[model samples]
Structure formats: structure tokens, C-alpha cells
Target: MTRDTQGENAPSDLDLTRLLQTLTVESDRYAERFGSRHGLHRTDVNALALILAAARRGEPMSPSALARELGLSPSATTALIDRLEAVGHVERERPSGDRRRVALHVPEAGLEEGRKMFVPLAEAFADSWAGFGPAEREVVARFLDVSTEAMKAVSAEWAPPHESQRRR
Candidate 1:
């Protein structure tokens, strides 16, 4: 296999790829445990995370947007939203002038719940990288940003068109 090598001591592309895969598996395992403890499915946890992130960015997501992000069918997305709503983790609101435009929100309680579940993990991550200097942290951050974009591009290319797309 063709490999991109930086130096004799530096990790090759294959090594980096394998490391990323391992990291993903470990991260998923953590999510699974959190989901179990919270009585949520892994998908539910993922959905909540997306919603929370969007809210933080001042761009609350609609159900359709969440469905696209999750690669879930409309019906399945609705069901997932219903489950979250039942558990008091999500709320649907019509905050726009157009009454039909519904936005997903994580209530204050839900936000606190998420913080309680994840802040320690975030702290642990921060602690792990505490030794890295400014330049090293910049390089690491750039690598992650590029890697995320590349993964998203590949996922978009491989994913089948959602129902909304197909209808257009």
C-alpha cells in the first residue's frame, strides 16, 4: 500500500489511520456507557449532542436537519425526537414568524444534564493535552479540523440522498 511518511520516526499514513480508528472505537464505547447509564440509545445521545451543539452556535436545528445529520429516515427521526421529548431532553418550538418552522431545543435542565454527563470527560481531555505547548496544540487542532472536514466529505459522498432530496 502507498504510504505518506513524514520521517523515519514519524507515523506513516497507515499508522495514523489505524490510530484514528482506535480512537473512534474507544470514544464510541464511552458514549455507549453513558447512554446505558442515562437510559438512552447511542443514537439518542448522538442526536442530543448535535442539537446541543447547534443551540450553542445559535443555530437550532429542525427535525429534518437532525434527520439529515443522523442519516436517519424521517419516520425514524420523528420517533427519536418523540423519545427524547418524552424523557424531557428535547423540546420542539415554533420560534420563527412562519409557524411551520419548528426548531429543536435542549431545555436548561437538559443542558445541565448534558454538562453533568460530559464535562468530566471534557476536563479529562483538556488534562491529557495540558502538556502540549501552544504551537503543538495549534498543529493538533489543525489536523483535527482538516480530518473532520475530510471525513464529512467522504460521508456526504457515500450517503444516499435523504427523502427530502429525492423528492426535489
Candidate 2:
């Protein structure tokens, strides 16, 4: 298929690849800075940050939902949740009429403990983007959104169904 070369669709795979790599490195630097404060592994801190952010956003996502959203396998998600729970960052709960379902909630300790480290790191990155003009920022944002959607589609096709469910 011939590619469009004018505007939004003009970027080639090479352009997208380079942008992805740049974003990954920048994000990792932020994550590493944030992780250093917690004495937790990078993945653990990232997972907790995700869960806490979702909780604060009123998403209150289940472990299965988190695994799907984060593109993590069920076992990996469970382990991540376990670590958070152990650290008093989250609580595992089963509300009435939902005996088999587990929901994760952010505890006060998690918020108080992690926010000092995480918030500043996030703000630093946000501040860096503040220099972009509106148009430039919009272009970058759209590219990221589209790229994310493309990965979601591709991952959905390949993710194992058996591993999709919350682990026992």
C-alpha cells in the first residue's frame, strides 16, 4: 500500500521506530529516578505507580484488567500485586456478592510513601514537554496515541488466552 506523505499519516515506520525508542529511553529515565526512592525494582515501582494512578483516577481496575492494560501476563501481574500488597501499598479485597473477585485499592501508606518520589519525577518530565509549541505537542501526542492503539491491536492478536485471566 502506498503511504500518505502530506500530514498526519506521513510518518514512516522508521520515523515511528525512532520515536518509540526515544520515548522508551526518556520514560525509563523517569522510571529509574522514581524507582531509586522506593528501593524497589523498576518493574515493581512502575506497576505500583500504574495501579495507584488508576486507583486515584477512580478506575479501581481489577488485577485481570491491570494485566490486560499493562500487557503483562497474569502471573506477572499477580506477583506485582503481591509485592505491592506486601509493601502496604495496596489492599486485596472481596466485596459482598463477589467472593471470587479480587479488587485492589490504594492504601494511605502507598500514597504517602510513593507520591513524594513519583510526583516530582512525573512533573519533571511534564515540565520538559512544556517547551513544545501547541502544534508540535499536538503532533507528538497524536503520534503517541496512534502508536499505542496500533500496539494494542497487535498485542491482542498474539496474547495467549489462557494467560489473559487473573491467576489463581
Candidate 3:
């Protein structure tokens, strides 16, 4: 039996955590650089990406959610949303139950434009992934799924008590 860093004979999530942190840093840098090439501000590009992601996941994107995800002030998020809306990248619709809340949707044109800009990078990733066998890819997929769940759980349960107040 092998021992992990804790010196106990057990498997651990430490590897996953380290890999995730490195991947997040490099991926964000790549996204920022690539988005800059397309003439969009990094934060604006990040917001657009988030909104698109939410739509793809069949979840609604509201300004509040975007703010938390992007770590932006509410006013900053509103401004970012306003810019996206003005450029036809996103459209804000008031949800039926809450007129005060804005639900964001990406226009088809925006998706098309994003695809045009990101396809080359996606192709590069596909080429890199080509080395992985099906079994390896499946394991990676499972790891990512579990990692995402872990992140969601911690985010929900472990924030500082004054964190929200500090923002206000």
C-alpha cells in the first residue's frame, strides 16, 4: 500500500486539487489572451463565456449570479451586462416570476461569432486529447465531474460569514 502526503495508507484528493488549481490558472490566462485577440475586454469575455455556459447547462443567467461567479461588484456586473447587451451578444429578458430579475440569453449570432473565434483553439485541444484512450478520457471526465461537485459543495458551505457583508 502507498501512503499519501498525510502519511496514511489511503487514496486522497490532493492530486485532483493541485491539478485543478494549475489548470484553472493556465486556462484563465489562455482565455484572457484569446479573448483579447478578439478585441473584447477580459472581464467582458469572461462574462459572455459564463452566460453562454449557463445557457448551455439549461440554467438561467442573472446579473446576481454573474457577479458572484466573476467576483465583480453588482454595479460592475450590471455594466458588463449592459455592454454585452448593446453589442447583441446577449439579450436580457425579465423572467415572468420576477420582473426585477434579468435572465440573460446569448444571441445565435454571438455563438456563431464565438465559434469562429474559438474553433482553432478547440481544434488544438482536440488534437492534444487525441493521445488519450477512451478509458483515460472517461476517467478524466469522471474526475472533472467530481471536481465540479466538490467545488460547488465547498462554495456553498465554506465561505466566511462576513464575506457577503464585506462586499456590501
Clashes of each: 0, 0, 0
Model 2: residues with Cα > 4 Å off, grouped in runs: 1-13, 32-39, 67-79, 96-100, 157-168
After TM-score superposition, the amount by which residue 134's alpha carbon in candidate 3 deviates from its true location, in angstroms, is 2.4
Q: Per-residue lDDT of 57-138 in model 3, one digit per residue for the tens?
A: 9999988989888777788888888888777788989889888888988889888888886898889889999999999999
- CA lDDT, every prediction? 0.87, 0.76, 0.82
Query: How far out, in Å, is residue 118 in model 1?
Result: 0.8
After superposition on all CA atoms, how large is the RMSD of candidate 3?
A: 4.6
Per-candidate TM-scores read 0.88, 0.65, 0.70
State candidate 3's TM-score. 0.70
Q: State the lDDT of candidate 2 residue by residue for 57-143, as single tens digits.
A: 877668988786666788898988888787777798886897998888878887887677667877987999888999998998897
User: For residues 38-152, could you state the per-residue lDDT of candidate 1 as single tens digits?
Assistant: 7899999999989988987989799999997888988999999999999889999998688988899988888788788789999999999999999999999999899889888
| Candidate structures ordered by lDDT, highest first | 1, 3, 2
- Which pairs of residues clash in candidate 2, taking residues 3 or more apart in a chain or in different chains? none
Ranking by TM-score: 1, 3, 2
